[model samples]
Structure formats: structure tokens, C-alpha cells
Target: MTQKVLVTSIFLHAGGEVDHLLRAEGFEPTYAPALTKRTEDELIGLLDGVSGAIIANEPFTDRVLAAAPDLKVISRTGVGFDSIDVAAATQRGVVVCNTPNVNRYAVAEWTLAMMLGCARHAVKNWTEMNAGGFKRFEGTELYGKTLGLAGLGGIGKEVARRAHAFGMTLLAVEEYQDQAFAAQYGVTYVDLETALEQSDFLSLHLPLNAQTRHLINAERLARMKPSACLINTARGGVVDTVALAQALREGTIAAAALDVFEEEPLPADSHLHALENLLMSPHVGGVTTEARQMSGVRAAENLILALKGQAPASPVNPEVIPTARYAVSAT
Candidate 1:
């Protein structure tokens, strides 16, 4: 029987390179691009005989997994696994993998861009200038500012490295500490409260989990300096959208720039759209051309490896691989 691999990410292999790579690996590839919104039923239908998949933000719930008994591996094109039911995947002995390191620099750079955009009123000033106005929009400089990082993972570390070059002091709230790295980067590992209070620009780089979801609420917003700006290039659920809207409305914080939101394609009637202090992007922080190509290749490689009964380089559920139905034998 020929092994089948489904490609669900809209942009994956759009350039033909990853498709060629998949074909070169002697696997039959099914292309079902979810250009707009993909329903759960659509995903279940696509998983008919698929042994592996390269997916985007599509939800692979327990029901969906139960429907696809042939699904042995799911290789995500990005770092987030929140859309997928990881616990269910583990229980079902389905290997879950993600493309990490590849997009960190891109996301980190986008975070910096958003931070600077908020600090310098880039969009507001440009709008005013284009609308026949001048000398009305003043901007703040990043020099000698305090930047707080909520998480210091790959992307957070890259953000710190760039921010350091701008002569900004760094403060972080990370579970694990690397003293040597902190010393080299001049970063002070502080409690979340202190990081919030002292930061001129607070950036979030946390993953979306139960503990991290809505971690930044109204109270946390109130703790931040009234003149400070918030930047989130991380998962949308990390901050409370309702509270952020209110905070921006009441000047609890001076401004915010977000690439991700709780509800993607941010609803047309959302209050966030009405807040001028909030800048929004449609979660394209990791969608650069280079990132897309790298992510696609990495995800394809992971899927191929998992299906070939080999261990994937970046498995989110490594514990499941040992007893997986497709586990490679140790020779």
C-alpha cells in the first residue's frame, strides 16, 4: 500500500519546491489547501487514508482524530500546537511535530517592527500625514527604553538580541534561567509584576496553554505604566481581548500592537477595531517568503520521517513515538 500525506496549509508547497521534495521521498501527496476557513468536517473528510499531514491552524480535535485511524503523524508548519488536541493525539499514539527554529528570526523581527510602530506612532502619523496634516503626531524613541519580555524562548531571545542593539535595557519573566546568556545579553530576570511595572514596552512571546491563556488581564494591564505600550506577536489567547480593548480605550496603557488575536480575522464587530491606540496585523508575523519556504520544507521533512518509521527532529509528543504503530525498529 502506498503511503499518503495530506498538505492542508494554504501556502505550503505553493512554490512547488516542497511538493517536489515530497514526491522525491516516494510518498503520494494530497493537496487540499485551506485558502480561507477549513471546517472540521472538511478536515475529517481529507484524512480518509492519510498517514501523515502538513497542517496550518486547522483544529484536529479528539473527534477528528478518532475519525482518522490511519493518521500516524501530523507535522505542523509553525510552532503553535494550540489548534490541535495534543493530549488526544498522544492518547491515540499519533506523532505531532512542528517547525520551530526556522521562523523565530522572522517572528522576532516582526515583533520589533510592531514595537517600534507603536512607540513611534508609525501608522497614526502616516495616516495624519496622508490626510493633509503636519507637526501634530509626535513619536517616542526606543533608545534608553526598558523592554520586558514575557517569555525568553527562541523568538524572545532573538527579540532581545535585536532590542539590545537599540540601546534598550531588557527584563524578562522566564521559568528557566540561563545566567550566562542573561549576563551576555544584559537581561535581568525579574518577576512578572516587576517586568510589567518597569517596562516601557512589554512584548509577549508565550505559547497558548491553560496557564498562559489570558495571562494578561485587566489587572495586569493596570499594573503596566500608563505611558507604556504592549506588543504581542505570540498567541492571541495570551492576552484578554476585552480587557485590552478597555485598557486602550481608557489609556491604561498608551498603545498596543498585535499580530495575533483571540479570534483570528478579528470579527468585524469587535471593539478592538474601534480603538485607535491599538494596532493590528492579521497574524502574518511568521508568513514571510523565506519563513514560509523553510517551514514547508521542515514540516514536509518531519512528515516524511515520521511516516518512514523514523524519529522526527521536532516532535511535540516525543513520548508517543516509542510505542507508535509506525515506530522504526532499532537495528
Candidate 2:
């Protein structure tokens, strides 16, 4: 007689809604044993009787959905639902939702930090200092530098707002460019070429779609100012890793910082390891403690609502939600 929630991703903390929902007044829940491609297969097995689920960035392939006929809702841990086949889920009458607006600050702050770190050679300096040596390092100051933001969505706007406080000139590229929005951010709307040519620092905030895949390839990298630094907190494949490495080797640009890569868990033999001017972090732009807890708790709230026969605020496919089993009952 008890309802269960299945978690398909590894969480930073276990005490969030996973624990809360399971031990709460009238709910039962279970977290997937581990997070791996194999775990996803196991999740499909566990999901047979589960009413709801909380998942991470792994691909929820159509095969997985075919196994969960009783599923009522899916709560994505982050803002992106691209990994999940939303159309397939919708056709199967499953409600899919995500936790939005939770990780914007974490990612925005990390993007700016990477920009500064690359400019100042922070990682290289630390490496030398830890090796017990005195070293001289040259670095550029951010004030009055031009920054080109490739996307002007929530995360991009936050980066722009903070960059303004540092007196940085901002140029942005958005498919949905609005002069009014640009004015509010104190940014000028520019074409990609213009922004690349003039920017001292380039930060990407776009998603990985057909038009954006390998967006920063050899030709585009060639357009950047020789002294410019590139920062990407957006999805991998947005910048071509091989092209970037070539640019760094030839000093086509000053330096590059990336929180995401063309491949996740960047391969052990990856050439990026040999680039002195490259600053890298494990695709953790949004992996702060606050973001983790917020994602978990927010996912739980949305899942709970859907399970209780109510509408969730951030359903990926709103139309599907209305026709889903739980939504029909709630309505």
C-alpha cells in the first residue's frame, strides 16, 4: 500500500528528499544503488513498481522507458532534460519535470572564477608554489576588458550582471536578442564574428544543439583575439577540444578554461593534460553543496506534487503532464 520513489543518480548528500520522502508521513522511497550506465539498467528493473523517480544527466533511452509502464512522474535533478527522450515519455503518458533556477548562481560564479583563474595563471602558480619554488608570473587584470557572452539566458544574465560590477564591457549573442534586454545588462548585442574579434574574454552559456555543436571550431577559434581567454560552463562539444588544443599550442589565444569537455571524465591520455595554459575542472560548474541540496529538495517537491495528483511547476512537457495518469486524477 506504500508508494515508492526511485533515484537513478548518485547524490552528494543522502539526507535530502531521498531520506525525507522515504521517512516522511506517508511515503516510501529508494535510491538506485550507484550511478553508472549499468545502474540505469538496474533502475529500469526497480522502476517496474515505482510511482515516481529522480534522475541525473544519464541518457534515459527509449528502452528504459519501455520497461516502466507504471511510472507516473520523472524528476530531473538539473535544468537540462535533453538526455531524456521527452517525446517518447509524453507518448507513453509519463510526466517529466526538472529543477530549474537552482544552479544558475553556482554555475555563473564558477564561470567567472575560471575566467579570472585563466587570466591570472592561478593554477600554474599554485602548482609551482606547492613544488617549493619561488616563481614570477604575469597576469592580466579584468577591469575594462571586453567579455562576449555566447548566450544570454538565466546563467548568462547572472554572469553579465556580476561582470558589470567589475567594470567589464559586455557583448552578448542571443538568437532571441532584444535591445531592451541588452540595455538592462549593459551589454551590446553583436554577431558571433564581431564578438569573437573584440572580446578579451569569451564565456559560453548555450546548450548543445545541432547549431551549437562544435560551435567553437578551428575557424571560429581563429577569429578570437590572440590575447583573449575562453571560458565554457555550458555543455561539452560546444567547443571542439582538438581545435582548442591546437590554438593553445600555437598561442592562438592566451589561455582557456573549461568546466565541461567534449567528453565527460576527460580521457586519461587526453592532450589537455599537457596544455600549460589550460585550466580545467570536472564539469562541476553547478556542483556546489547548495546546488546539490537545492536540486534534490526541489526535485522531491515537484515529484511529490505530481504523485499527489497535482501539477508541477517545471514539467518539461506540460501537455504530457495533463494527459499523464497522475495529472488526470489531480485535475
Give stretches of model 2 more than 4 Å off: 12-18, 22-25, 33-40, 178-181, 327-331
Regions of model 1 farther than 4 Å from truth: 327-331
Candidate 2 positional error at 136, Å: 1.6
Q: Candidate 1 on 176-293: residue-level lDDT in tens?
A: 9888889999999999999999999999999999999999999999999999999999999999989998999998999999999997778888888888898999999998899998
Overlapping backbone residue pairs in candidate 2 total 0
Expressed as tens digits, the lDDT of each residue in 1-331 for candidate 2 is 6776777657723566557654573566776644444545765778877778888866666888888877888888888776788888888878899987799999999988998898788877888899998795888889999999999988998999889988899999998876776787689999999999999999999988778999999999999999999999988789999999999999999899999887666888998999988899988899988998888888888888887777888888789755556642321
Clashing pairs counted in every model = 0, 0
lDDT of each: 0.90, 0.83
